[model samples]
Target: MANKKRQTEFLLMLDKYQGTIMKLCLVYTDRHPENVKDLYQEIVCNLWESYPRIRRKNNIPTWVYRVALYTAYTHQRSRKRSVPFIDLDDGFFETVASDSGNEMVERLYSLIDRLEPEDRTLLFLYIDNVSQVRIAEILDTTESAINHRIKRLKQKLKKMNENEEEQ
Candidate 1:
C-alpha cells in the first residue's frame, strides 16, 4: 500500500510537470524528436529515483528543473562520443519545421541552438521567468553569478543575431 501510494503521487507529479519536462528536453536535444523522447525517459527515471527526497523540498519546480536539466546535460555529453544510436525516419526535421509557423520564433530558436549547453540552460531558465535567486539555487551558483551570466548571455545572443544578419 505504501508503495502504491508513492507510485500514485509520483504519477501525479510527473503529469503536472510533463510540459515543463518536455520543453527542457526539446531545447536540450536541439528539438530532435528521437533525442527528446530519449531525454524525457531519462529525466523521468532520474526524477523517480529522487522523488522521495524531492517531494520533501519546499519548491517543487526548482527541484524538477534541476533534475531535468542535469539529466539533459549528462545525456548530451555522453551522446557526443557515442555512435548515433537512433536513425529517425526521413522528413523528421521537415515535419518539425512545418509545425512552427513563426519566422522570428524560428530564428530565435536557431540562435539559441547555437549556444553552448550551459549557456542554453541558463537562458532557458531566465526566459521561463525563473527568478535569478531561484535560478541560482537550481544551478547551485550564487545569485550574483546568475546575474552576470545572464547579462553575458544576452550580449552573446545579440552578437549571434547580428552575425546571422550579416550572412
Candidate 2:
C-alpha cells in the first residue's frame, strides 16, 4: 500500500511538471527531437531516483528545476560534440536586446541554444518567470549573484547585438 501510494504521488508530480522538464530537455538538446526524447527519459529517471529528497523540499518547483538542469548539464558534458553553429538573421540579436518583453522572451530560446550550459540554465529559469529567490535556490547561489549574473547576461546580449551591427 505504501509503495503504491508513493508511485501515485510520483506520477502526479511528473504529470504536473512534465512540460517544464520537456522544455528544458529540448533547449539542452538543441531542439533535436530524437535527443529530446532521450534526454527526457534520462531526466525522468533522475527525478524518480531523487523523488524522496525532492518531496521533502519546501519548494518542489525549485528542486525540480535544479535536478532537471543539473541532469541536462551532466548529460551534455558527457557527450562528445563540437560547438554547434547557430545561424540567425541580422535582427535576431537586436530583438533579444529590445524593450519588447514578450517578443524578447519568445525569442530567448534561440539565444539560449548558443549559450554555455550554465548561462543557458540561468536564462531558461529566468524566462520561465521563476523568481530570483527561487532561481538562487535552484542554482544554489545567492540572490545577489543571480541578480548580478542576469544584469551581465542582458549587457552581454546587447553587446553582441552592437557587434553584429558593426559587422
Candidate 3:
C-alpha cells in the first residue's frame, strides 16, 4: 500500500507539471520532438526516483524545476559531443502555428537557446516569476548572487538584441 500511495502522488505531480517539463525539454532539445520526448521521459524517471522525498507544498514546482533542469543540463552535456543532427520533421512547428501569438514566444526561445545553460535556468525561473530568493534556494546559490546574475543576463540579452537589430 505504501508503494501504491507513492505512485498516486507521483502521478498527481506528473499530471500537474508535465507541461512545464515538456516546455523545459523543448528548450533544451531545440524543439526536436524525439529528443524532447526522451528528455521528458528521463525527467519523469528522475522525479520518480526522488518522489518519496518530495514535499507537496506550494514549493513542489521548485523541487521539480531543480530536478528537471539539472537532468536537461546533464543530458545536453553528455549528448553534445556525439549527437548527430538529423533533419527533424516540422511536426512541432505545426503545433506552434496552431497556437496563436506564440511566434514571438518561439523566437524568444531561440534567443534563449544562445545563453549558457546556467543562465537559461535563471532566465526560465525569472520569467516564470519565481522569486529571486526562491530561485537562489533552488539553484543552491545566494539571493544576491541570483539578483546579480539576472542583472548580467538582462544586459547580455539586451546587447544581443541590439546587435541583431543592427544587422
Candidate 4:
C-alpha cells in the first residue's frame, strides 16, 4: 500500500512537470533525441531511488530539477561524444510552426548551446524563471555563485546579440 501510494505521488508530480523535465533532458543531452529519452528514463529512475529522502512536499520541482541535472552531468561525464544540440524533434517543429516566439526562442537556445554544461543548466533554470534561491538549491551551489554566474551569462549573451546586430 505504501509503495502504491508513493508511485501515485510520483506519477502526479511527473505529470505536473513533464514538459519542464523533458526540456531539461533536451538541454542536458545536447538535444539528441535518443539521449534525451535515455536521460529522461535515467531521471525517473533516480527520482524513484531518491524519493524516500524528500521531506518538503512544496519543493518537488527543485528536487526534480536537481536530480535531472545531476543525472545528466554524471551521464555526460561517464561517456563523451560531443554532440551538437541542433537536432530537432517533430514536436519541436510543431512548436516552431505554431508559435510566433519560434525565432527568438531558437536564437536564445543557439546562444545557450555554447555554454558549458553547468552554465547551460543554470541558463535553463534561469529561463524557466526560477527564483535564484531555488536555482542555487537545485544546483547545490551558493546563491552568490548563482548570481555571479548569471550576471556573467547575461553579459555573454548580450555580447553575442550585439555582435549579431553588428554583422
**Number of the predicted model whose TM-score against the real structure is largest:** 1
Off by over 4 Å in 1: 85-98
Query: How far does residue 25 in candidate 4 sit from its true spot (Å)?
Result: 1.0
| Candidate 1 lDDT, 1-167, residue by residue in tens | 99899999889988999878977876777576666777888999999998887545568888999899889889999878776555575464336424367888777677678888889889888888888999999999999999899899889878977997899
Q: What shift in Å separates residue 119 of candidate 1 from its native position after superposition?
A: 1.0
Q: Backbone clash tally for model 4?
A: 0
Each candidate: what lDDT?
Answer: 0.81, 0.77, 0.80, 0.78
Runs in model 3 lying further than 4 Å from the true structure: 55-58, 82-101
**Tens-digit per-residue lDDT, 72-140, candidate 3:** 988898778766565556575336323346689878777878888888888888887888888998999
- Model 1 sits at a Cα RMSD from the real structure of 3.2
**Deviation (Å) of 157 in candidate 3:** 1.4
By TM-score, rank the candidates, best first. 1, 3, 2, 4
* Residue range 1-167, candidate 4, lDDT tens digits: 99999999889888898888777766665455556666777888999899989999988988988888889889888648655454446564344233346688776667777888777887889888999999989888899999999999889878877998999
What is the lDDT ranking, best to worst?
1, 3, 4, 2
| Model 1 residue pairs with clashes | none
- Per-residue accuracy of model 2 over 11-73 as CA lDDT, tens digit each: 998899988997787678755444566577789898889887754655888878988888888
Q: Which ten residues in a row have the lowest lDDT in candidate 1?
A: 90-99
Model with the higher lDDT, candidate 1 or 2: 1
